[model samples]
Target: MTSTADIGLGTAELTKIFTTATRIKVCDEKFRSLILTGQVSAQYYSPRGQEIVSASMGAALRESDYMVTTYRGLHDQLAKGVPLRELWAEFFGRATGTCKGKGGPMHITHPASGLMVTTGIVGSGLPIANGLALASQLQGTDRVTVVNFGDGATNIGAFHEACNLAALWKLPVVFLCHNNRYAEHTSFEDGTSVDRVADRAAAYKMRGVRVDGNDPVAMHTAAREAVARARAGEGPTLLEAMTFRFFGHQMSDQNEYMKPGELESERANDPVLRFRAALIEQRVLTEPEIEAIEAQAKSDVKDAFEFAEASPLPELSELLTDVYEEV
Candidate 1:
């Protein structure tokens, strides 16, 4: 068991995770601004308060490792090192985007960084991750696949079926459930039968662990172990990262359904800010250094947004360019 002593992370590594969370937060905040100003008119699921889990998990992954996430996956992509300019252009529907402006925010797939799949369907990513892991197994490789989903998606049939198969085959995949309390406006209590989503892992004879996804130390520990187990061909593990979203299900959502004081209470625990404060508290990083990192994040986001705005839109002829078969 990894001790609580920084989880075997040095000052540099811990700083990387903190900066990653900050970058994801800043990028999403910029998107929220663009969405409000009507400059970017596209549907998006914001990862507002849930940046830490993606940062911790993405930091743990090797460049060869695969990941599958949902429509709200800006945190995942940015932490995995997706170029900001391309991502911003995609959201703006420009030709320079990741999918050449076709995939948008919901269907981003950058395989060069091992982000193999970005499925918008709830719970569908689980089975798809299994398939990717299966391919790695057949090829005699140890590349692990991390499938990320929300708490509400656990109720879907594919989540269970994939978990069962991965366990039976000892496939190298990690089922990471980002339990942000509410699954698209519905609370987990109203959606799930079990208390913690990790508890479901026992049903498939796999190890189950739950932790504060907001805390860098705890999240990194669980992620490291789960990833290692998969690399060793020990089958899958379910890691339920308990977190809260600072915004609505989407940027346009009014979030009238959120319980009173819920959003307000979670403000004190926003992972992005919390991690930065933690680094300072632990004497690993000074406040000025943290501020500099945050400033850089905002600068990068600004540059990307400017580039996207200045870029050319897809040509009219491109309508049939990426298309394969006529419908």
Candidate 2:
């Protein structure tokens, strides 16, 4: 475990990361439970093992900085400070959701929190992030834009195009790839040509880094440096966060494609649990404090669930509304 001090992260920051990750973990668990029991039904993609990656990356940005993420972005949304109630409401398709229940889980958007878009299409958010960064540049603000995607998105053409444009224009953007070692059911080795996704950054003349996404300290350090460089008008960075998903690609997937013992190994090294232990070991957080955090997360999730259940669904008229501007 890297010392938080060595990474320039104090106790407060570490606590925030742990708290965010815990909330995400708890939220994911609750969501899965809801689905299993038929309480809520939606196309869900579990971000179970990628909690620390989003938490640490989110810790590096300011509230005003922009972020774009993929459908598997509950962690990103939560880490970016989206209210638990609103997120749950959106997931539940309640009228009070961020998108007024029109977007559902895959399209959550909250501009107030700088979580601008949750795209369902793979590799689509990269160019959108570039647009946001270009806007910030034109407005003469230091606000950076971070786009989160899975390793599979890198194989798409948009990834290369966005990277080239971002580099050529020196856009203040960060291309964060959550490399969970699998693209849906396809293993990384079977799909990708490169040994490391970060290596592709060289082709576009951008800085690249590959770090242990499960390690809070290392993940935060890499994210912070990338964010700082972007804020200082440096070109974009390609950060490959190495991680693994404990669950299958989706809720129904049994991970039949994964080799035997792989899932078990990753689960045994669960990032959330590891981070919790590290916090206690480093004295950054006592066991009581950690328990308190976990308790609070559960309380928040419960409240959010209740709020979503109580809220009404969108009106039938809403189908016609928000479809087009009345110019």
Candidate 3:
């Protein structure tokens, strides 16, 4: 029952959130099209239902803040301001990519936008984010680091180690668990002992919050509070964002594991569409304005895809170039 006024976000902020969510949705649609058309042959994870979680979180941060995300991180990368052209080039394995076509979608690293690491390993980003936060603390910089992981990652040993260290040292890090209920093929009830992931934060004496990830206002408010706390030297916060992925774990997954009507129900409640309607109802944006925003996103994604297709692949000499650095 959170109203617009209670959300504490103005018209501009709401519009920004809607715009970001629309961009992510358009990019995702374009990506799936590429896969279906056989234009790209890489592993893909569709962030179909969890757009608002990343979009709102991204809107809460500054350009200088650091972020670490998982392999299923296209949404995270796009929301964090990774250039659409370079991102598409990387997907297409072109030399103009963030990693010069080496990393592909799983390992997108754009330091300029403070998206430092896109790790393929589960639970690995937590410790890396801690290291970045520690450096910021030692250097007396107020930079906050945000680490995004799935609910399954909470079971990893690194999760406990990172949380303990962050709390013990009061590091400026935010542990964001995109709890979509299912961990790969396993459901949360089957894999996790605890009902709520945020409840575990008590073991390390850190603040814990659980919010609806599909709601832009709720997600943004939680993220803003966590980021502000970290920046103000208040220490780390475990913010568990509850969401659901509309697609399966990977591109090839048929979602056979999902219960009857589960997928259909979630699709009917798509967050992107929900937010669009909310904005229009609040008078923050009109239907035509929203349509214009969507058109821009579509055009931008089309241009990026074309640019990627026209870009050249990495040279053979590149195999040995980034292997070792000179002293």
lDDT string for model 1 (179-271, tens) is 999888788999889999989999999888999998888898789999999999998999999888888898768778888888888987667
My TM-score estimates for the predictions, one after another, are: 0.96, 0.99, 0.98
- State model 2's lDDT: 0.95
Sliding window of 10 residues with minimal summed lDDT for model 3: 1-10
Error of 2 at 50 (Å): 0.7
Q: Cα deviation in Å at residue 60, candidate 3?
A: 0.7
RMSD of each: 2.1, 0.8, 1.0
Q: For model 2, what is the error of residue 185's alpha carbon versus the real structure, in angstroms, after optimal superposition?
A: 0.9
Please rank every candidate by lDDT, starting with the best: 2, 3, 1
Q: Please list the residue runs of candidate 3 whose C-alpha ends up more than 4 Å from where it truly belongs after superposition.
A: none
Indicate the worst ten consecutive residues by lDDT in candidate 1.
1-10
Q: Residue 289 lDDT in model 3?
A: 95
Better of 1 and 3 by TM-score: 3
TM-score, candidate 1, is 0.96
Report the lDDT of model 3 for residue 82: 93
Candidate 3, position 304, lDDT: 96
lDDT of 2 by residue, 1-327 (tens): 587767678999999999999999999999999998988899999999999999999999999999999889999999999999999999999999999999999999999999999999999999999999999999999999999999999999999999999999999999999999999889999999999999999999999999999999999999999999999998799999999988788899999999899999999989999999888888899999999999999999999999999999999988878878999
